[model samples]
Target: MNDIRVDIDPALLTHHVERLGELGELPGGGMARLQYDSSWAEAQDLVATWMREAGLRVRRDAVGNVFGRLPGTDDSRTILTGSHIDTVPEGGKYDGALGVLAGLAALRALAARDERPQISLEVVSLCEEESSRFQANFFGSRAMLGLVGQEEPRTLKDADGVTMAEAMVAVGLDPAAVATAKRDDVAAFVELHIEQGKVLESAGVDVGVVEVITGLIWEQVVVTGRQDHAGGTPMDDRLDAVQAAAEITAEITRHVAGADGAGRVTFGRWDVRPGWPSIVPGEVVLSMDLRHTDPADLRKRATEAREIAAAVAARRGVEVTFERLKDETPTRMDPWLRQALADAAAVCGATSMGLPSGAGHDSQLMGEHVPAAMLFVPSVEGRSHCKEEFTRPEDCVRGATVLATALHRLAY
Candidate 1:
């Protein structure tokens, strides 16, 4: 076995995680550091301070994406790595933040290597990604890729009616200057993130080389039924929207379940109108999340799912509508970069496997505009998006060490 490794300062990395974890920590557990919020602002400033300490040029863009740059001798093009800084509501600590910290640690390690890279290297802390606060998912990455619409800032809103533009202004960012956030110099992007699934843990692998991000189909299914007094109407004479919606959702689950591991679906959000003790619900809406790795298969599955929903509603004497919320195609990682990451893992004495990411990530958007790849560390028990989510500290350090070695290989 041949191995050449790069070591990261564990103490320094642990300090970074611990200090930042405290900023948006909930009283009970987990984190909620949404973009442009006070906790988020504090965390961003703290990371920038650490970047300066690492001898990198630190700057926040128009939309609040923070970058720590180590300029190359040529300085014309750049290689970028890192993850978002924002967290999902009640999200675990490791998801996106680990990637940023790992990149920061890697850059710091490289800074001490006595030779600068041939191309500029940067570690980015993207501003908004989770969509936990606003409907503007991948806001930072989209801005960087020059994909943001002129009305996005003014139209995207949070639960509190706060427009993305208003939130930008609140953070001292001029929303009108968002166009300036676009960049054409990023040549390649790599993200190191927790797998957030059971793949690596079940396979007993140290890391995963992501093959592709799964394509997703999101829709709102609204079932309409006649409202009637629950106590006064005969059971056979009443049309219950909630009951019809429930049957449709159950059928969707069964359909995806029959696809084995090739497909998945979730009805995560629901609303029954005029919730009351004696009145049957007249309308119910269900938010549907669908996924598959193959584009054709995903489309076929989504179409079948819609048909199933309509059939279920018809059988229950109700009207249904399918409103598309999002439809994203699968993003394949750069093959060259995937191989590079695999080789880097071997160099660090860690086993690697090829896998697909089930969850959407900023890389899915970034890969559309630039060469992008991702690496995954194991998540304990496949837990994520909750307080119980965790990755072992040793695994964290090992993954970051592999990332540092990879950065050295690409940059040096």
Candidate 2:
């Protein structure tokens, strides 16, 4: 292990977390920092100010990805770090915020060094990853990878029926120039994030070196059935859309439950048209989220899920249609970067373990375009995505220190 150590300030890290957490805070506790919203815009501006305070050149991309760059003696390539800034509805503070702050602290410490690195380092506050406002998941990363379609901004709409292009204009971003956000200089990406699960906490490990991120499939299922009054339609003659949708979701759940603990499925969102209590529902829309680590297994399960839905719809005499919202293959972390992170944890006197991430992250998409790895700090009680989510100050600093150590090893 190298004898290099970066002095990560626990107080500073905690302070940043607390300050950022207050941006989109709700009346009860959690936040809703959706992309292009006012709260999100404020958070991005604050991060830019902090990046400037860290002595890094700051810039925002056409899609609103905020970057803080530290130049190197050899600036031909850059080592990228950080995470998304947007949050799921009612999300807790630490999920995506910690990674961006940790990267900021790491780069700040490295900037005070006497010697410069061969490669530049940048900390990015990715504009959107949670897809809370629109159906565009990984919008920031996709912009960098040049994967976002030209029509997306004009077509994708939010709950208020505002298009993504109008939202971009509201935030002073040019939807027409989104193609310019793509970069060819990033050589590697390292994101520091909370484990968001109990694997590390249960094993008493301080940090986790993520090996792979599970593949995911998002399907929007819409069921159509005859609308009839509850008094007029007999139970035997009624074609109930809600009944069919519920049955399909239940069957899909049972199938995943039997997949030996490696599969996951959730029917999280539901919408019923003509939602009167007495009405036999005319239409119902629901979301299906399926996940597995193996690509072929994921594909097989997705196909099975579709078949099950079809069978249920046919049996119930309701017409069903499915729209694929998102389909991402399993992504493996770069081997060398994973080892470097483990070694860095060892050097910092923190126990490390290799684990697969059950939750999807921006790294899953970033890994497909550049060499990418993730460092995970333990989340208390494995809680995440809720108001109770938390990580200790020491563990937060330890993870940041390890991130700094790894960057030193890779860039220096």
Candidate 3:
């Protein structure tokens, strides 16, 4: 290991984060820079400028994944760091932004010393991870690994009916050149992000070295029942889709509660046809988001939940269907990388623990093709995907220092 001290300026990280936040400021006091949007374009430009200022070579791929390279003594392979920059709707400042900023800070700190690593260091602002605009997650990572299917650009659409291809072109990125985004030289990847859950904060831990990213099973459940006039039909005579959906939702929640150990189920979105007070709903479409660290448990829970939904629909005299939207298997972080992170945390005198990430990340996708690890800073109250999400600057600085130390060990 190199006898190097990891030093990062907290004010610099804060300044870069605040500047990125200005690009997509929401009235609700957070950010909303969805993929390929105008705000996303501007934010990418700002990051490009910062990378150039830091004496790194700045470049963007076809899908708009930005890379700032600090060349090393031997550039045979590169050590990749950073995270996605696109924000969720009403997302906090630190979620994805902090990872990118921290990567820059670490690289800049090394550059200031006129030091070069054995392997090149590249800080990436990945293009999409939240899927806020289109149903595309890990767009930038997939492009880097050549994992994106050819049909994806035409099939996915945003709320405004914009195809991903159109959005890419609108941002002056070539859609046809997506294949050029794949890289053969990334030796390893490390991402730093907010914990996005209350576990670290509740436990008073300064950092979390992730063991695994949870597997996710997203499904759309549709309950079909007969519509009846609210006034004319007796309660016993009506077969209500909304009631069946409610019962199934409650049952799913109960099942998840019984599973124990970081299992989660959310029925966040719903759509009811003929949404009028006078008419009973004939159809209800609700989304199910189930996650767990164990792949078998995740699949079992999904199957059981679907069966329960069926039983609930049968009891309510309704027909139900479960349409799976996306199913992602659990991914384990590299053990060596985890150890390096733990050692770095120890060096920084920061408390660290092994925790599973409850949320999805591009790291999971990147893990499919390369060795990937994630570092976590505390999220106050474990809240995320909302404006109320926050992580203290002290925690942020600690996380970044740990990241810097680990990157130094890997690259230098």
Candidate 4:
């Protein structure tokens, strides 16, 4: 393996991570940098300030996706890198933040080069990816690709009941200008992110070269049963919604538990009506997420889940209805770009192997329009979306260095 050094500042990157973590930091731990919220605005502004400090031309698109551009000799095409700025509520600092900061460091290092690249390089801090505020998936990337529906901004609301359009206006952005963010010149996209899984750490690898992002099926199940007083109704006589919902959840879990490694399922949200000690709930809502790398297998799992839900509801004396909140097809990284990432890792003296991403990323959506690839640094213990999520500083710099190496080959 050829040892190549790319100028990446470990201390600065770690410092930036600490600083950004403080923006939406909670009382106990983790961050809450939701999209279009004040914390998100503060975080984006801070990143913009840093971009300016790096001497790049900084601009915020209509949807609030911040871009720092280093123009190339041939400005017609651009090479894109970076990740989302938003996070899940009380999410770990490294999940999305590392990708954005790594891109910034990579671009800054590349800017100091003596020769210019053939294509421009841009680091994007996407406005939303976690969907913490609205149900709109990949808002920033969708906007960039002109895939957002016209009515989304005016229609979607947050927990505060404020429309997305209002939130945009609050941040001094015009929702009407969203169409203007559609980009056609981005030739390639390379995002640097934490693995958020145990693959790299367990295998004693430094970086993960993502091959495919899993397909997902999101189903919201609402179960209805007879409500009865806990004290008045006997256990055998009660047709409780909670019991039915619980049984349904358990059975669904059982269905996927013994299955092969090709599929996985999780029920994250459970809302019980009349949430009181004495009430036997009449309604229950559950959020089900089914994922797999193969499209056919993913669909089969989804169908099997539906059948299981129906069977469970029938047996439990409950009426169940399902609503699909989101359905995403599997996304593959560009083959050549994937090879470049692997070669870059070897050049950077970091061990890396191609792996499938269990969690979805902006790269999954970005792949639709541009040649997209991703580099993953290890998440300590594979913990993510929580305060315990972390990556060693040295590994962080190593991932960024690899990204820089890849960018040098792609752009320069």
RMSD of each: 1.6, 1.3, 1.1, 1.3
In candidate 3, position 123 carries an lDDT of: 98
Candidate 4 scores a C-alpha RMSD against the true structure in Å of 1.3
For residues 1-412, write the lDDT of model 1, one tens digit per residue: 2244678999899889888888899999999999889999998999999999999999999999999999998698899999999898999888899999999998998887778888999999999888788877688998998888877899888889999899889879999888889999998999999999998999999999999999888898889999999889899987899988988888889988898687889888898888888899999988998999899989988888889978887788999999997888899999988988899998988999999999988889889889999999999999999988888888888889988888777777
Q: What C-alpha root-mean-square deviation, in Å, does candidate 2 show against the real structure?
A: 1.3
- Give model 1's TM-score versus the native structure: 0.97
In candidate 2, stretches whose alpha carbon ends up further than 4 angstroms from where it belongs are: none
lDDT of 1 at 201: 95
Question: Runs in model 4 with CA error above 4 Å?
Answer: 1-4
Please list the residue runs of candidate 3 whose C-alpha ends up more than 4 Å from where it truly belongs after superposition.
none
Per-residue lDDT tens digits of candidate 3, residues 246-297? 9999998998999886789999899998899999999998999999999999
Question: Residue 131 error for model 2, in Å?
Answer: 1.1
Candidate 4 C-alpha lDDT tens digits along 289-349: 8999888888888888889888988887789998999999999999999998999988888
lDDT against true structure, model 3:
0.90
Candidates' C-alpha lDDT: 0.89, 0.93, 0.90, 0.90
TM-score of 3: 0.98
lDDT of 2 by residue, 1-412 (tens): 4669777777888899999999999999888899999999999999999999989999999999999998988788999999999999988999889999999999999997888988999999999998889999899999999999988899999999999999999999999999999998999999999999999999999999999999999999999998999998899998999999999999989998997588889999999989999999999999999999999999999999989989998998989998999999999999999999998888889999999998899999999989999999999999998889999989999999999999999998
Worst 10 residues of 3 by lDDT: 1-10
